[model samples]
Target: MLDLPSILNLSGGPVGLFIGSFLASTLLPGGSEAMLVWELQQHPDQAILLCSVATLGNTLGGLSSWLIGWWLGRRYPGRGLSNERQRLALKRVTHYGSPILLLSWLPVIGDPLCLAAGWSGVRLLPATLFIGLGKALRYGALAGAMGSLG
Candidate 1:
């Protein structure tokens, strides 16, 4: 039988946990929070490193989704989006600008939000900054919660 505690600890380690969490943040469905918290409990000394890796991994995954969206936008040229929907989404993005990225921390919609931003041809630098900020906030929150519980 697999040792659940050991498995959790390993999965939550700096490299393994980061990769898993990062991939999960993309279109794929997975989550690393439990592993992260478990690792924090098991290895307090590694909390900061774990948190940083998780955040960077997640950000890169989100960026991958954004790149996919950007590429699709170029190839498809908004073919799938209705004019009205495009207009409305565009208006929201334009009005709110980078702040909309804060919502990227949300569950189902968060990944799509990043994708949509790229699809909308949002400025690359601003989009990257906002995504990074949102991802950092998420990791910080998770780390804080884990610290409290630990």
Candidate 2:
């Protein structure tokens, strides 16, 4: 059983990983990959737990961003995307719908894709499901890869 120090030792373990993953999944300017990788290296036995926690945290963060976009869509009915970049993003997601959320794990545009889906009024359940799937797959792959680093 891991304790607080296990979580706090290397800039916080699983808990810290959850928080970092959550923020990184948002539009915020941060990346949890470094911390995640470091933690995985330190605690190889906890890989599944760590990855699951990260995925959950990240999915929640993506949902927060999606909900914000939904709120914006509600708050500003007629006021659509303010700029060309957002417009283009809206176009891409609109072309594919919820399935496009598979790319929500992408680097630069992933968060915006979720935002676009919300702004464009994509269904909530499917979008959230796809987002979670994409994130889980990403974490699974990363952790699987990390398993070989020993």
Which candidate wins on TM-score? 2
Total colliding residue pairs, candidate 2: 2
Off by over 4 Å in 1: 1-10, 82-91, 148-150
Model 2 per-residue lDDT at 8: 70
lDDT of 2 by residue, 79-141 (tens): 878777667778998888888888888898888888888888888899889999999999888
Q: Against the hidden reference, what TM-scores do the models get?
A: 0.79, 0.88
Please provide, for model 1 over 1-150, each residue's C-alpha lDDT reduced to its tens digit, 9 standing for 90 to 100.
888768655544777777887887798988868767766777778767877787788888888877876887899994754355444554566678767877765677777777777787877788778887887777778888666324
TM-score of 2: 0.88
Superposed Cα deviation of residue 110, candidate 2 (Å): 0.6
Candidate 2, pairs of clashing residues: 7-12, 7-13
- Candidate 1 global TM-score: 0.79
Kindly report which residue pairs in candidate 1 clash with one another.
none
